[model samples]
Target: MIDPSENPELWDFLSSLHSGELLTGTIAAIEPFGVFVALDDGPDHPLFPGVGFITYPELSWTPFNEASEVLHVGQRVSCEFLQFDTWNGEARLSLRATRPDPFQLFADGIEVGQELQGRVTEILTFGVIVEVADGIEGLIHVSELAGTPCQGTQGVVRPGAYITVVVTGLDRQRRTVSLSQKRTSKGSP
Candidate 1:
């Protein structure tokens, strides 16, 4: 029997793949959490049909309701190689990393105390996450949710509701934007 480990071609192919390299592939499978890609003109994965893989968050810069909304089986894609997931024995790929980050753009154009309108995407005990722009969401802490103290986010806002908020803080490096729903006399600059 031929020993698969002894194949020089397999070693050469695996050796050629490096993190941060761009690779072209076809979607071999789609799961709730990620997508499996069959690399074009590349050696097959020892365990999977393709070597490239993209997690849910890495699938797109824009928020998606489902994996099918962004990718379908056999769809061609170009993705950035993040790393080789040793545990899963697959290449960790990112489709969003290949696209422009909307948060970066929003941060560059706005500043603290600026009033912006956004849609509430999620309501948590501590805060409400609002989508201020495409692919850009900001957190409105419980303290900032309203003028008066509230027991929880449910008292302040609901998902899909539109609200006006003031930019309270920002962390460009971390991609975090803090917003306040409390009404303020000061106007946005």
Candidate 2:
């Protein structure tokens, strides 16, 4: 929804950009939620200092603890236009779109049933998250947790514990990986 309070002309300017079109800008501000970019060719924002924005997930392909770890204010960057932020009246850009997807690279060499060792990054009631490759995490569903019918994952695993898992599924369309711990063993991190 386009914010009625914002300038309509600004929205028009942003709508002119095509998705995946490369846009160059300098980091104008860094907020907890995302970064603001001062696009080289854009109107000055009515409310903000810049008319370009990059959300945290669009900033990088590699996982990080914070946006500061990957970007900083005043840093120049080239980002692919993702869409127009009608509500915010800014250009939504993706810095990661300018780079190759790491998940695709990891999937190129692997297939189903391949056994890989990775650290258990998270454990949920529904599944366990294992980091099988850089920026890639596979979900081991609760049903696939153990060989024998399992009770729960309460004391089964903890974060940072290395475990071996079989690649049960690869969803290229969604860019997701699914693993199973049923026929595997716990290993060292």
Candidate 3:
């Protein structure tokens, strides 16, 4: 049996966790290797002498330009514990691997006709990806951006711009969110 007092730091860390612990930590450092977090302090401390770690596979699909962009020193973060891995002393952490993603908050709350304010994150030939809320990205297609028959999505909206839009549909399975700015200008869709 593992004695908790022998390794107080590790014990304290384990004490702060549960089966599916969701907590926030700050980025203490980011190396090409992985991200390190100052685990002791945050909105929720998951460990006593708080520390965080991120490996290669965990950074996938994080929308970070570089590993550094994924996190920065002193940057706060949110993640869930996959469960304690005593076999290897590896407590797998996931910042983007939560089930029933928190993003669904916006999806679940939005109605087809409800108006919303969204910030453009990326522009594609077919549509613009707007982040209506943190982790919640909705798309405004070329046709839905404007009713004037614009050239493309770029013609109607630009990245970093905020626009008023309407939720057209919610695809929970595919996680595809549909929005329309033109619907509001044209008086409802």
Candidate 4:
């Protein structure tokens, strides 16, 4: 079989035709709606001026008001091709598609007895959600927070605090990561 990498142009064109293709290009223009890119320094033409997508500004609220603020001309970005309009032949893409997901990260990096530092994201009656890294979140059950029989998660830990925790166990089959903040701390519960 011929090597696909031998011809970059043939690869991009064929790859674009396939669903779930990841395309990377430099942003050529940014309007209120979306940002456009120039694929492999390709010519600016109506048929294909690279791939573009209009993202809701709320997706990245703090730094962006419109697409222009989020992406400037000549910015590099990677996106997944979501779908192709069979009739109009326009390609749809999403930036969020690049994220692998929290549970996957947890499964990859965690081991029993390993210590990790994370920010508390959510506190619930059952437990608190601690975010360790981008897309990696784990649950610290109320029972695991302290030795005492805690009534609520707040009594054990507060949100937005950077807390050190330990991985007690992992249910790989269920994709759940069990952690304990009390075990990691110096003092006893």
Scored by lDDT, the top model is 2
Candidate 1 lDDT score relative to the true structure: 0.79
Q: How do the predictions measure up, each by TM-score?
A: 0.79, 0.81, 0.53, 0.54
After superposing candidate 1, which stretches have Cα over 4 Å from the reference?
A: 1-7, 85-89, 150-160, 186-189
Q: Which ten residues in a row have the lowest lDDT in candidate 2?
A: 180-189
Candidate 2, position 9, lDDT: 68
Candidate 1 collision pairs: none
Q: Which predicted model would earn the best TM-score?
A: 2
Global Cα lDDT for candidate 2 = 0.85
Candidate 3 clashing pairs, residues 3+ apart or interchain = 39-50, 39-51, 40-50
Better of 1 and 2 by lDDT: 2
The Cα local distance difference test for each model comes to: 0.79, 0.85, 0.66, 0.63
Off by over 4 Å in 2: 1-15, 184-189
Write out the backbone clash pairs for model 4.
Answer: 102-135
User: In terms of TM-score, which candidate is stronger, 1 or 4?
Assistant: 1
lDDT of 1 by residue, 98-183 (tens): 88888888889998989899899998878889988877899988877673574666656778988888889989899899988884
RMSD of each: 3.7, 3.5, 7.4, 8.2
Would you list the rank order by TM-score, best first?
2, 1, 4, 3
Error of 4 at 155 (Å): 2.7
Q: Which residue ranges in model 4 land beyond 4 Å of their true spot?
A: 1-16, 20-24, 28-51, 54-71, 78-80, 94-106, 168-176, 182-189
Q: Candidate 1 has what TM-score?
A: 0.79
